[model samples]
Target: MLQVEDLHKSFDDFKAVDGVHLSVEKGQLVAVIGPNGAGKTTLFNLICGQLQPESGKILFNDDEIGRLPPFEICRKGIARSFQIANIFQRLSVFRNVQVSVLSQQRLSNKLFHPAAQLAVNETNHILESVGLLDKNADVAGSLSHGDKRILEIAIALGNEPELLILDEPTAGMSPDETATTMALIQRLAEKQGLTILFCEHDMEVVFGVAQSIMVMQQGRTIVQGDPQAVRENTEVQQAYLGDE
Candidate 1:
C-alpha cells in the first residue's frame, strides 16, 4: 500500500535519513524501531510532507507523493498521529472528530452544506471505533493521557485512511494501558483491514503487535523481517533493538 525508495534527507553535513527503503503491504502492520537519533521520526516527516526529502521517491499506490504538500498527501488517504497528542484542549471529543470528518468532506467539495450535519454519521462511527463514544461530550483536555491518545487515533481515522501511521501510540501509558492499547491496535488492524505503520520505542509493544519489524540506526534501516526473525538477528542484537 506504501513504498519508499532510496529515501534520503540531510541537514548541512548531517544526514537524518539516508538511503532508507521499505514497504507496508495491505492490511499489514510494520513497526519501526531504533535508538535515539536514528531518524525514525524524520522518515515519517518526509512521508507525511512535513519535511521534504533531499532525494528519492515516496509512492502511494501509483502516484509519487514526496513532493506533495502535507494536506494534499492527507487528501490522498494517509493519516498520521504525532508522538504527542494533537488535540484541541478546550474542544469536546465529538468536536475533535467532527472537525476531521468535516475536513475530509471539505477536501472533496468545500461548498458542501452543513459540514456538521454532513459529518455527524461519520463522527459517531469513528468515536465508537476508537472507544471514545462515551467521552464524546467531554472536553479533550479533561481526558486521561491514554484516552487523549485514543482520541488522536480517532481523529486520524476520520479520514478513512487506507494507511494509518502512528508514532508511539502507547507512550506514557501504564502497563495495563499499554496492554489495552496494543490489543486495540491489533484488533483494529485485523477488523478494519487498515494498513498500519508505526514507530515505537517499547520493544514489548513492537514485538507483540507488529507482524514485521524494521530496525533503524544512524538514519538507515539495518534490518527488516518478522518479529521473531528480527529479535534473533545478530545485527539487530548488536544494534539498538536487541539490547533490550
Candidate 2:
C-alpha cells in the first residue's frame, strides 16, 4: 500500500537518509529497526511530509505524495503517531477523539452545531477500538503513560487511515504495557485491515510482532525480509547487533 524508492535526504554534509527504499503491503505489519542516527525518523518525516525528500518518490496506493503538504498527505489516507503523545491533554479522552473525528468530517468549525453531538458515535467507536472506551470520560492528562500512548493511537484512528505509521509505539512502556500495545497493533492489522509501519529500537518487539522487518544502518537499508530471515541475517547481526 506504500512504496518508497531510492529515497535520499541530507543535512549539510550529513546524510540522514541516503538511498533507502521500502514498501509495506496492504494489511501488512512492518518494522524498521536500527540504532540511533540510522535515520528511521527522518525517513518517516519524508513520508509524512514533515520533510521533502531531496530525491526519490513516496507513493501511497500509486499516488505520488512526495511534495504534498502534511495535511494533504493526511487526507490521502495516511495517519501517524509521534514518539510523544499529541493530544488535547485538557480535554476528556472522548473529546480528544471527537475533535479528530469532527475535523475529519470537516465539521470542526460548525460553531452553530452542538459540538458534543457531532460525531458522537464515531468518537465512541474509535475509543472502543483502542481499548480506551472505559476511560473516555477521564481527562487525557490523568491517564497512565501507556494509556496515553494508546490514546494517541486512538486519535490517529479517528482519521480512518489506510496506512498507520507509529513512531515508537511502545517506547516508554513497561513490559506489560509493551506486550499489550503490540497485541493491540497486531489485532488492529488483522481486525481493522490497517497496514502498519513502525520504527522501534526494541529488538524483541520488532522481531516478535513484525511479520516483516527492515534493518537499516547509517541511513540505508541493509536487509529486508520476514522476521526469521532477518533475525538470522549475518549483516544484521554484524552491523546492527554486533556493532558495539
Candidate 3:
C-alpha cells in the first residue's frame, strides 16, 4: 500500500502537481484519469522519486520515502513503465529483460555480463507472463509496435514489483492491441495480485480494467471513486467526454 499527502511539484514557477493526495491499497487497480497536463505523470514521478516534490510526504506502507532515489523506490517494491515504448533496440528480448533482473541484484560489475546463462531462468519466466516468451531471441527493434509496448511491460515486470505504475499502457495501439494489453493488466492484478496505478487518456481502457478512478484537472484531483461514479461525475463528463 502507498499514501501520498499534500504533494506539490513545480517547474520554474509553473505548478504541475498542486497538493494532490491519494492512496493505493494492496491488490487494487486504480486509474488516474485526466486531461493532458493534469499532473498525473508528475505525481507518478514524485512517487517514484524521479522528481522531488516541492513539498509533500510519500509513504510506502507507512515508511516515509519522499526523498528516496528511483532505484531505492524500485527496490522498495515499486516499478513503472513510460507512455512511450522504451526498449533496447539492438538487444534480444531476453537480454532486455535480463538487464532489469540483473539490476535488481545490485551487482555493479555484472552490467556487461551476457545474461544468457546468468538470467535465462528468471528472464524467461517474466517474458512468459507478458506473452513474449517465444520471441525471446528476436531482435527487439524488429518487433511490431504493439509487441514493443508489451516488451516494455515485461521489462517492468522483471522487477517483480508489488505496485506497478503504468503511464498510458494502451497508448499508440490498435483497438485489438489495446484490448489485449488491458486484459493482460487485469489478469496481472486479479491473478498475480499485483497492485496497479496507471494514467491513461483512453476512457474505454480505464473503465474496462480499473476498479477505481481518480479524475484530475489542472494539477488537482477533482473526484476519486468507483469507475461508474467517476463516469457519471459532471466534472469528469465535462472535462473528458469530448476528448474520448
Candidate 4:
C-alpha cells in the first residue's frame, strides 16, 4: 500500500535519510526499529509530505505522493500519530475526535452547527475502537499518559485512513500500558485489516506484535525480514542490537 524508493534527505553536510527504500503491503502491521539518529522519523516525515525528499519517490496506492502537502496526503488516506500526543487538551475526549471528524469532512468553517453534533456516531465509533468510549465526556488533559496516547490514535482514526503511521506508540508507557497498546495495534491489523507502520524503541513490543520488521541505522535500511530472521541477523546485532 506504500512504497518508498531511493529516498534521501540531507541537512547541510549531514545525511539524515540516506538512500532508504521500503514497502508495506495492505493489512500488514510493520515495525521500524533502530537506535538514536537512525532517521526513522525523517523517513516518516518524507512519506507524509512533512519534508520533501531531496530525491527519490513516494507512491501510495500507485500515485506519486512525494510532493503533496500533508493535508492532501492525509486526504489521500494516510494518517499519522506523532511521538508526542497531539490533541486538544482542553476539549472533552469526544470533542477532540469530533474536531478531527469535522476537519476531515471540511466542515471546519461551518460554524452554523455545533462541532460535536457534526459526526456524532462516527466519533463515538472511533472512541469505542480505542477503548475510550466511557471517557468520552471527560477532559482530555485529565486522562493518564497512556489514555492520552489512545486518544491521539482515536483522533487519527477519525480521518478513516487506509494506512496509519504511529511514531513510538508505546514510548513512555508502563509495561501494562505498552502491552495493552500493542494488543490494540494487533487487533486493528488482524480484525479491522488496517495497514499499520510504526517506529518503536522497545524491542519487546516490536517483536511481539510486528509481522515484519525493518531495521535502520545511520539513515539506511540494513535489514528487513520477519522477527526470527531479523533477530538472528549478525550484522543487525553488531550494529544495533549488540551481542546480547
Question: Which clashing pairs does model 4 show?
Answer: none
Worst 10 residues of 3 by lDDT: 107-116
Candidate number of the best TM-score: 2
Which parts of model 3 have CA positions greater than 4 angstroms off? 111-115, 241-244
Better of 2 and 3 by lDDT: 2
How many pairs of residues collide in each model? 0, 0, 0, 0
lDDT: the better of candidates 2 and 4: 2
lDDT (10s digit) by residue, model 2, range 20-114: 88989999999999887899999999999999998999999999999999999999999999988898889999988888888888888872465
lDDT of 1 at 159: 85
lDDT of 3 by residue, 122-198 (tens): 88988998899999999999999999999998999988899999988888899999889999999889989999999
Report the Cα lDDT for residue 177, model 4: 97
On lDDT, the leading prediction is 2
- The local lDDT score (0 to 100) that residue 102 gets in candidate 1 is 77
Q: Each prediction's Cα lDDT score?
A: 0.87, 0.91, 0.88, 0.90
- Per-prediction TM-score: 0.93, 0.96, 0.94, 0.95
Looking at model 1, residue 172 earns an lDDT score of: 95
Ranking 1 against 2 by TM-score, winner: 2
Off by over 4 Å in 2: 111-115
Give the C-alpha miss distance for residue 196 in model 1, angstroms: 0.7
The residue-by-residue lDDT of candidate 4 on 1-244, one tens digit each, is 9988888999999999998878899999999998867898999999998999989989999999999999899999999999889999998999899888888988867624643367889899889988999999999999999999999999999888999999999889999999899989999889889999999866677997898899888899888889999999988889864725
